[model samples]
Target: PICLLDTIGKVFEKVIATRLSAAIEAAGGLSPEQYGFRKGKSTLDAISKVVKTAEEACAGSRWRGGSKSYCLVVTLDIRNAFNSADWSRTLEALQRFNIPGYLQRIAPNTSMVGFADDVAIVVVAKHLAAAEELANAAVRAVESWLTVAGLDLAAQKTEAVLISSRKAVETASVQVGGTTIRSQRAIKYLGVLIDTRLSFKEHLEYVQRKASGTAGALSRMLLNTRGPKQATRKLLTSVVTSQILYAAPAWAKAAQVKTYMRGVEATYRLCALRIACSFRTVSDEAALVIAGQVPLRELIRERAEIHTAVPGRHPRGHGGRGAAGRQRPEPQEGTGAGRDSQPSDEAGTSADPKRGHGSVQQMPTRGYVPIEVEEATAPFAVQAGQAAG
Candidate 1:
């Protein structure tokens, strides 16, 4: 096998794509659920969504009638996703959405998500059965829409993941277009490894391997620092670090993953050390200084510093001190995040203790399993912060 890697799409192609995508999006052609390929929405939006949903499902409340909730996330590539846009079906969809005809004419080889050719559907429910039904319904809707749009669902590559306590019962497998979607202990969704346990251990290992692989290739390319000058080292370092920290703030929630990110940066540190011909045992902080790179954890933390970072502002959402911090809809009384009856000193997204949701519950641990509820009425508040926001 042979393959040629080229610079992403050409400049002119991207300009054309940007113009067309903006138009389509403005016309409501793209779904909000598709955080990828959009200008403002990011991988964090998608990840936080699934995470918040899973957290809520695991934290069952009386309002949910005490049913343990679970989450199933399905990701699939639209067959020939890029060029699969059908003229007739597009027009049909446009009409169905009431998009004006003036904006409906798309050039050949144009599509939503431009070069990003995948989509993911997330379903959260109070029980495995509800989750499966919701997932099935969502898949059917997408399948029908794709068929109409001259697209096919790559069911073979479709991945189904169940997120719940280990004590929770196994769920029936999901089927798309008569092909059964295989279950995975951990599946990469929007570039993050998500396991049923939400431990983030699998994601950490995957990123470690990915960063390690990139470092190996770079090492060979640099000829062990016998080639490439400072500029090259800096550029390569940037590229490798970017790979390691792609969505750091999301998966970094796991403490162990946080520690591993630092180790990944160490590989970059070693490469830099060798480039400077310094000893491998040199302090990591010193190597980072020589490489002109920030520690991976600190890099993510610094990025977090840029957003609406005025004094007293929350990590996300639009607000300032004395302002009600922005949040997702608070989980309802019977929902997962609202199970506890005692309120915390700081608002745990609840103030009045009247509802059983008023208290701060113990966070999930390896041995501890809490009940959860799937409440469309209340998605968990406190979304994952946008890594690129």
Candidate 2:
């Protein structure tokens, strides 16, 4: 019984939902673990929480001298969750949360780590059996609640994964509604693919394949002399790159591996070459410079840093200024005594690459070159000298 609301009705519905959400938030009725549909929270936060918890559990087990560190993540899918919600139970839950009676009367309708309807139950233990027991208990609790609320659990669609070291990997089972969900090597949650070992190799491969297809299409359309202008092609490349780097903060650490970094860089370099309208023989560094793009590795690191800086934004508080109470170091003053002791211009300025206008810096041999270099360098070099002069 799905009812499609008219334009005016949809607007009215949004207004009411907004007010109700504001009230609930002001009342502190939601748990911190909830990240679905809440303002100022995102899927990245949920993903980060899962990753951090798993890593911490594994690390703790290692420190205690046990090779049995493991994490079990069970993702539940509710079929038609919102449409199947019982209004009476919803109002009752709201009442239990101490929501206003007047608001409850007005709300006959409406709807993560539990985003909207995607729920992931995570548990970690030193032993596989212990982890399975904990996961099963949590699943049963959620199933009970869903039953009481008149929602159907899509057992077939639900997935379970046991995250652990390769040497300690073992199989486990989770049951819901009399169906056993076996552990898989990987599971996709909120558009990111998470594997049993958290190596993110599969996810990276997935991104590479998708990005390569996009780059291939763009390459065809953005030919050297036949397609969109450089600006237009670059804009398209940026959109594709953003899609490729979605949820980077959660899995960026995997880029530390040489193989992973190379795979990502190769895909990104293809886009850069397309945007720059350069030959395939161009070096990755040169292509990125021509395309006016930073390396994917640096970009991912920057995104991770930014995510950490936002308070209550990251799942785990790493020395970030937000609520973590980490004091940011004060900027040092430029003392007159050491002004001349600074590194020579040839050594280059320490300006952040993100803030700088161009990737290329002036060097002794290179002198000052135009920030934007082209396939043919002679004319640009002459232009560079004129601009510098």
Candidate 2 Cα deviation (angstroms), residue 346: 44
Candidate 1's residue-wise lDDT over 1-389, tens digit each? 65543656556456665665655556654433444545565565556556765666666554257644566777767666546554554455445545444445543244343335455655655556666765666666556645544567787788878877746446457879898875688888877898988888887767767877877777766664367887676667556666766655556556445565555656667666655556767787887677655455655554344322321222431112212343333456664543233323211221112222221111111100111122233542221111000
TM-score of each: 0.66, 0.73
Shift in Å, residue 320, candidate 1: 26
Cα deviation of 170, candidate 2, in Å: 1.1
Candidate 2: clashing pairs of residues = 112-115
For model 1, state the Cα shift of residue 365 in Å. 30
lDDT of predicted model 2: 0.62
Best by TM-score: 2
Worst 10 residues of 1 by lDDT: 362-371
| Model 2 segments more than 4 A misplaced | 1-14, 60-68, 97-106, 109-115, 166-168, 313-389
lDDT (Cα) of model 1: 0.54
